[model samples]
Target: MIDPQPDGHLPVAAEKRTADGTAPDLEHGRMINGGENLWMTEIQSVLAQSGTKKTTAYLSHECRMERLPHSETYLGGGREIFQKEKPWEFLTYTQEGRIYQFGNPAVMTVPPSSEGDGTFPPAFEIKGCNSQAHCPDRQIYYFDYDEIHERLLSNQISVRSLFLQVSWSTGGDDWTLYSPCRYVNFSNPAFQTSSYIQPIAGTVLMPVGDSFVPGSIACSLNDKGDHIIEASSRVFRDMAEWRIRQEQPPEVARKSIRDVQQVMPTFFLSQDHIIPINGTVRLYRYL
Candidate 1:
């Protein structure tokens, strides 16, 4: 587990910029097609780093948001309504037959934007169900990505990284996490087909004090052909530490050392799993 901050919060690193005062280079180590949009360029960088040849930038075709449900439920008659006031402490999504249970707040659900066409801007729609009462129906809440981008640019909000869960179904269901500019590989052979693919986007951390803590998406399958998805902060902590050690100078890394680990600027993590599914499931998040 990541060591908790002295003040009981996750460490936040300031956004890095190039010496020229431009966005940090997404393809720093490798030579790839540098695109106009920094976000898309960073995603392409990830694909290139993951051993994907002929990497190209693409926008998400569809996006959906889901969160883990509260453990306790309100029983009325024969129906059980998921509690909305308090969500489960952990983030999780599980599938059993047609019923799906999510354990985090519903982050986003919208169709892909057509603004830049082939290019990816920080453009998207944010919506969720109303949490005011124990309403069983989902309500439409609307917001734009420009507002979010403005907040990040102005330092009104501090986000460490944006994480996306990419999923597809071939003979079975396969999914992986994707973050722009992070080196994570989804080695499934089905990824090459690029059919029935969906990208679930969201932040990987929960708010703590003035900053956010890191979390990871863990995917698994069961004999019953069910998909088990979990949001694990512990796994994210380990990955962050490993990345830090890998980036250190060879000589400095050779020595035994203990440093407060922080999720580096423009960092992300992703994993892949496969199972049988009827259709695609997508997720997205914004704050």
Candidate 2:
């Protein structure tokens, strides 16, 4: 579970960067929980001293902001409010088998570009994208390494599952593993692997928002193991609108916390209930 930075490579803190994501295993492999971050202190310190405030991050939106309630939780250990808490709050998209994103990926066909040394060749992200894929569905990120620039292009969600790893430098080039969006079906590298080593069973369930309206969404999972996702209609908020930096705004938006604030699971998975409880919560805020 060695998390590379949003972009592939960043040395982990000598102490925290245990060369892996979790505990070292001598036999098969090592698995260090990504949450045991060495930089938690720095984030806390920076926020504390710099007068920065923390709004809860969650699963559904473009930039991950899942700040759930748990023991030793960041803020006082009680239930944490995230994504500014939508009008009808308290659920996330992770309840169902939505291993990719809570929202849908906007589909666009890009031509080609000469900027990204060909990696982007005016593809989906190279050109421009529809403002639909932001929240929950857009909570994916890759390492921003000097090389291997992986952009979540505003196009179709082609891959079945994605494995995002983030590691970064802190003390003297030391790095820390952040969160992870582990089982994204849109980019599953093991798509070919068919043999099931273990048999598991379970159900997945998501929380629905206020059906108080005549037409409200009811989260549910359909057969064939697909989560009945809520496709957000025309996204109004743009990352540029919230930009606090002087640098040129990115052509594509990285998603806001509110988009994912459904606060309830989109649906539920019964058999082989595999849903992520705790993982990396990464995002770039405008304001």
Q: What is the TM-score (0 to 1) of candidate 2? A: 0.15
Q: What lDDT is reached at residue 233 by model 2?
A: 18
The positional error of residue 232 in candidate 1, measured at the CA in angstroms, is 12
What is the C-alpha lDDT profile of model 2 across 1-287, one tens digit per residue?
Answer: 33445433333351122222221111121111123221110000000001122121112212333454553535334555463544222212221122122322111122211222111101111112111111222222332221111222222121212222222222223221222222222222257422111111111122112110011111222223333322111111222223312243444322322333223212211122122222221211110
The TM-score of candidate 1 is 0.17
lDDT of 2: 0.22
Deviating ranges (above 4 Å) for candidate 2: 1-86, 90-164, 170-175, 180-182, 185-287
* Most accurate candidate by TM-score: 1
Error (Å) of candidate 2 at residue 53 is 16
Candidate 2's error at 65, in angstroms? 16
- Backbone-clash count (model 1): 13
